[model samples]
Target: MSDTTATPTRPVNWTAISITAAVVMGGILAALLAVAPRDDGGIAWFDPMIPGGWMAWTLPVAIFFWCIASLLVTFTILAIRFPETPRVGVLRIETTRGDRLFISLLGSAFICLVWLFFAGLPVWGALALCLVYAAAVFRWV
Candidate 1:
């Protein structure tokens, strides 16, 4: 009988991963608070978070970057823990988890652009469609 399990090149340093996750989460929380509008006008430390109208940094843009960072971190952890081998999917080409992630992200971007052209802003509906599209890509593509 032949063994199938692939051995990891190096042991995963769980402490480092945990610390990284904590830092990522902390940054996200800090960003959220920074963009939050307060009735006190953000004067004192206890007043509230930072001013939202600081340069080009908007709440939505911050959240988007945070989400992207979180996804990358999650995928990195999964790769370290599971170590996937590229497999052929519906596309009849070998693809790893990272490849699927890339495809989904690219497709989602296109879907948003097309949806914007036809449906206009408040992209909640487009977001739902993108979620479905991403699920489909991860499942079969």
Candidate 2:
């Protein structure tokens, strides 16, 4: 004799994945389109990425914030679809996905700041270092 009750299978959540992809792609597109004014330097008419009051925000700054927003959206989706248990990493502390993400972001910021201090702008090198630091944080903390 078989049991009357049975568990249902979990199908892949393509909709969640699609929405996450759209957020990331749209962010990238916005980053690419973030341009300062061709002629006028004033904030009243130019800057697509930044608002009127924020004259200090440039393409790099806009892209950085956009990337952070995209990451938050992706992580939210992941947490909802696949819940995870906190795991101990090299830091000797238990960390959930969100915790790990926070650590990574914090470390990457310091890394970029240090790189900027030592070197100079055109921050490609700093970005590369940040990427590696972020990967290592995710892998081993």
Candidate 3:
């Protein structure tokens, strides 16, 4: 008898991947652009003729990137440590490495948005968010 352990087929979910990439990239870009604003102790108006103004824009992007990195590392660690767990929802999830990555990146964006809504936020916010995300992902996904 011939061995018949065929490779499992992957779902053709290009749309999901595309949307994920677009949202993540867009958020990062917006954040970077809003990173810095030059102020020389004077009232400065919007001037397209300025040079360093572009630097201010990089802040948001930097924060977004930082969030992503923080989430990725945090989730990876948790997923390995905890292994698989049942969630409060109607599904039991096995924490795969790929799932960990996806959840981390996506959840990081949401956490960053929430932080932004509550005035000036810090990198710690992102770190904390990653921790919560790791738990939630372990439970749910």
Candidate 4:
């Protein structure tokens, strides 16, 4: 047979890709929620080496910004590589991945805000809630 290795394969399964995108975004959201500090008037910092003894509010915020930057990179990649079939589906929107990421981000932000308000949990306690939130979102959603 003639060599045709240079020929490109069929298009990727955007549906599956979108799902993964959703999951990843969700995970990032969970991480942000978990790391964010609670509103309680207690100092939550401790030995950095210890497992859960110490954590600062800025850590999660920094992580959140990083994840957002990564998502931006992913968007750029998809836009450049798949310029033709960019949209996932009409039902989802022009870009389903973007939509999902937006929703996940918003939801996580909302959760964080709520925790910041009502729970009044200390930094350590918020960390526990964040872990549970991440688990539930990943497993259920």
Candidate 5:
């Protein structure tokens, strides 16, 4: 008699995931734009002022640009290909891949907000601070 347990292993297909997400989001946005009402001034109620004029086309174009930016960030993280090195940090907490990503993204948002609050300060400083914050997060969350 033999007893065996198989471990499940599924590799992430980022390309497929990205494509599916884009298609789904595009469909939803298209439906929204199609059903969107017009304002008294004849502009789309759902459309706001951006670099381009407010129209059905602009929403999808803006969404596409945003998706591109998101994909770039995701690809950059995938390119790093960091191993799941869960380690106890200064706070005595074990950090994993999701934890690191969350910490890094949160730190970045915090850094950007601080930079915006202090409008006249040098942005280089904020970038440096963000780097230090990321290092510290990876070291000791």
Candidate 6:
């Protein structure tokens, strides 16, 4: 008699997954930019709402690109160097990669909103806060 229990298997190659995710994110960004509406001045339609500064000229796109790039780099690094790092969950519950990503994105949005509501200009401050939030989420949720 043969016992039939399924055993879990690790992915054969995390590097490929990381590279694929980066390429897919880049493609999505490119597609969005390609179809996004522009104003007469060649700026994005939402440029007026974005804060102005040396690096804020292309605010939304810059932030979006930065976030994606950060995620890609982080995933690559984690996959290559810290594949065994344990992921913490919300309320001490077990969490997966998707959960952590969701928490990070949500935290970032909250940070941006709080910054917009209470503070103005120099979004770097908010970015710093968001980075801390992301770190906390990854570490403890």
Best by lDDT: 1
On a 0 to 100 scale, what is the lDDT of residue 130 in model 3?
72
Global lDDT of each model?
A: 0.80, 0.76, 0.59, 0.59, 0.66, 0.70
Question: Candidate 5 lDDT, tens digit per residue, 7-125?
Answer: 88999776786677667667766665655446785646446534364564455455555554564556455545555667777768787756776777687778878887986455778
- Highest TM-score model number: 1
lDDT (Cα) of model 2: 0.76
Q: How many backbone clashes does every candidate have?
A: 0, 0, 12, 0, 0, 0
Q: What RMSD does each model have against the real structure?
A: 7.1, 5.1, 10.9, 11.0, 8.8, 7.9
Task: Please give the distance, in angstroms, between residue 40's alpha carbon in candidate 5 and its true position after superposition.
Answer: 37
Runs in model 5 deviating more than 4 A are 1-85, 119-122
TM-score of each: 0.72, 0.71, 0.35, 0.37, 0.42, 0.50
Which tens-of-lDDT digit does each residue in 93-138 have in candidate 6? 6676556867798879889998988988868999999889888887
Could you give the candidate ranking by TM-score, starting with the highest?
Answer: 1, 2, 6, 5, 4, 3
| TM-score computed on alpha carbons, candidate 6 | 0.50
lDDT of 4 by residue, 79-109 (tens): 6556644354423445444554565566666
- For candidate 3, lDDT tens digit of each residue in 15-130? 56556656776676555445344469532334332355555434444555666665665555555555655333424554465565676667877887877777455668666877
lDDT of 6 at 113: 91
Looking at candidate 5, the ten consecutive residues that score lowest on lDDT are 45-54
TM-score of 1: 0.72
Tens digit of per-residue lDDT, candidate 1, span 15-119:
898788979788876868665655557523333234554555555666677788888888898898789999999999999889999999999999999989999
Worst 10 residues of 2 by lDDT: 41-50
